[model samples]
Target chain A: MIGFISEKLTGYLLKRETICQEEYEIYLFGMAQFFRKILVDATVVFLGILFGKAWEMIIFLIAFRVIRIYAGGYHAVTPFGCYLLTILMLFMVLLSLHFISWNLSILTAVWIFASVLILALAPIEVENRPIEEAERIYYKRKVRVFWILENIAILLCMVLHLRMGAESIVLAQATLGMALLCEKWIHGDVRND
Target chain B: MRKGVVKMVLKKVAYHEAEKSAKIICGWFFYQPKLPNAVKKLRKF
Candidate 1:
């Protein structure tokens, strides 16, 4: 629904003759995506306020963004699907916040488990927009490095008694692992159609 | 005046394809910042 509106407004305003169809396509798509993102953020933040943890959600959002930059997760195929995934992920993070007091061993175990899955699936790419071969290799390595640093940052937060930060990182990584596994199951990483 | 169903359908498909194409060209594994150079490299136009 949002995509329909955003696209029509953009198409009506954009001078298609001045620019090529590809450019028009890109602009319309970007606008729809931007609207989708806004909707997700608004809904999540509203839910956070309702739960009386709006600030905590902000931290979780930041951590999720940082981890997501390098750790590829499932990308829903459509706007509605994206909204659903975002909502589910946000609630999952909020629910996981209760694990702040998890025993060191258990948290470490979960971290290790999540790390294995993410490293296994980092740098996953789309088929239609395939990256250059060399860039793919470089990005894969960088993702691994970033994952390690992210884990270390989580540990540091825990040690410093930043419970919210720690739990946010934990949620982010665990969600990443879950997303990768689910995406692989539904659409194998190699066979993205 | 009634809006034709076919016209609405045509607009929906056009927008959907436009969005889908942009998404395809941009890639979808991770959300990287859309830097100008990256956009240039991704889009031939």
Candidate 2:
């Protein structure tokens, strides 16, 4: 679906000669990614609404994305695989949220443990997308900054007695930790290899 | 729409939209397909 729309748009642009021939491939790739991102996000939001956990899901999405931006965890090989995996992940998260109820102490403990785990091992690179040493250092520092900010946000939520908000952040951090471990286990530590 | 108007609109889209989209695809480490070699060659950052 995303590819078809992007190709159609690119074809229109080509017919009109808006973009030159050399730019066609780049534009096609970018437009396809843009469409794919929109579709995935829209689906997530729709699921959140359907499950009556809209705010919590949105908070989880934001929290997860902020760390995932620089931390770089498991990436499915194909675009369709990534899309399916994301939807499945979200479904599991929402379903878990529906069933599990965490006490403040458990949430805080999980948050602390996950935060430390992520800090110790992050910016995990994959075979498909390898990170240079310099870029790896930069991403490592950048992820720490985001991680600290999330901690602060979680602290504020806890202080304010916002159970759902705190849970969202903690859950996101824990999920990210799991993703990092999975990426390492699946791909092997490229740095060490 | 007339040919001229369509061309004008598409020209704007081709420039602004393409640049914006490409910048985002490059900037984030989000889960998406690998960028084509052509796009990777043109990456400024």
Candidate 3:
């Protein structure tokens, strides 16, 4: 479906002479990406509304993206697979948020534990896309800055008695920690074999 | 004059979108800064 739309857009662009044949692949990939992002975000927003946790969903996305961008983990094989995994992950996070009776102490503990996990094992290089030393050093430093900022925001929420806000951020942290661990385990197995 | 400006702006936007899309295709779908050009080249090689 996304491919068809992208192909149509590419054909239109080619007809218009806006992008030449040489640039076809780039535009097709970019437009498909543009559509994929919109689809995922729209679905997430719709789910958040349905669950009445739109605010928390937004918070989770920010916190999670900030960490996950640098602390790379668990890439699905295909674009469609990635989309499905994202929806599944969001459902799990939102459902847990709804059901969990989160308290300040528990949230803090989880945040601390997740912080440790992420700091220790993040930027985990998959066999396919290994990180270079320069990139590793750069991303390691980058991830720490975001991690500290998240901690401060959580602290502020706690001081302000915003339990739900803190819980959302902490849950995001825990989600990344689990993702990192899963990726690490998978990487280890591949290495052993 | 206006058409030239519009074309230039569209070109910039297209470049930006292509860069971002390439990164997400390489990594996961999320906000990530473009890696240094040196690193990008080295990875490609």
Candidate 4:
């Protein structure tokens, strides 16, 4: 659906001289993905609000975005598939958030597990986003630092007994772990042979 | 629709295409795209 819309929109943009014909392919795709994301995000947010799980959705989005920026993950085989996987990922995060909310101990466990994955497999690159050897070394260190800072944020929330904030970190870590698994072990695209 | 909405629409298109192209280019960067399906399929589920 979005792919189709983006095509038509691309035509419209070209006609209006908003984007050059030479650059329109990328622009077409960029617009399609942008609207697709916006539409997807709005739909997910609406669902979250309707189900009274708005906070979970918000936390999941934030956590996923933060980790995803540094730790690239597997891209879907196709554009539509990518959309499906994204929604699925968010749903998993929200579902697990409910379970983790049952006990702070579980949240602690999740945090530790996520920390391990980040330490072990972050700066997770893929065929889609190849990195230079030097760049790879740099991102590895950078990603770990971000992971530690995120963990610290969770710890602060935990110590203060700010349950919601703490839970957000737990949710974030869980989301990160899933992305890592898909990018590393599942896709089997690690840098090492 | 408003004029702002139109511009936002254009920007979004550009970004999406840029992102996708970036990924495709990266795949081409390594031998990933050129890999024999036989070898890669062995790794697949």
Give the per-residue lDDT digits (tens) of candidate 3, residues A80-134.
7777888889999888898877876777688888998889987765544556667
Each prediction's DockQ against the real complex: 0.08, 0.31, 0.19, 0.16
The local distance difference test score of each candidate is 0.60, 0.74, 0.70, 0.62
Worst 10 contiguous positions by lDDT, candidate 2 chain B = B21-30
**Candidate with maximal DockQ:** 2
| Model 4, CA-based lDDT | 0.62
**Native contacts retained per candidate?**
0.05, 0.24, 0.08, 0.26
**What is the DockQ (computed on Cα atoms) for candidate 4?**
0.16
Q: List model 2 lDDT by residue over B4-24, tens digit each.
A: 787666455544544543333
Task: Write one digit per residue (lDDT tens) for candidate 4, span B1-45.
Answer: 697687666766465445543433222101112222222222211
- Worst ten in a row by lDDT for model 2 chain A: A126-135
Model 1, A100-130: lDDT tens digits are 5666786778788888887888656543345
lDDT of 2 at A18: 76
Docking class of 4: incorrect
Give the per-residue lDDT of model 4 (tens digit) for A68-142. Answer: 656665566565666566667666656665664548678777878877876777666665455566666766776
Q: What is the lDDT of residue A13 in candidate 4?
A: 75
Best by lDDT: 2
Work out the TM-score per prediction. Answer: 0.70, 0.85, 0.81, 0.75
Ranking by DockQ: 2, 3, 4, 1
Candidates 1 and 3, the one with greater TM-score: 3
Interface RMSD, candidates in the order listed: 9.2, 4.0, 6.0, 9.7
- lDDT at A192, model 1: 50
Over 4 Å off in model 1, which ranges? A15-22, A99-101, A127-129, A191-193, B1-45
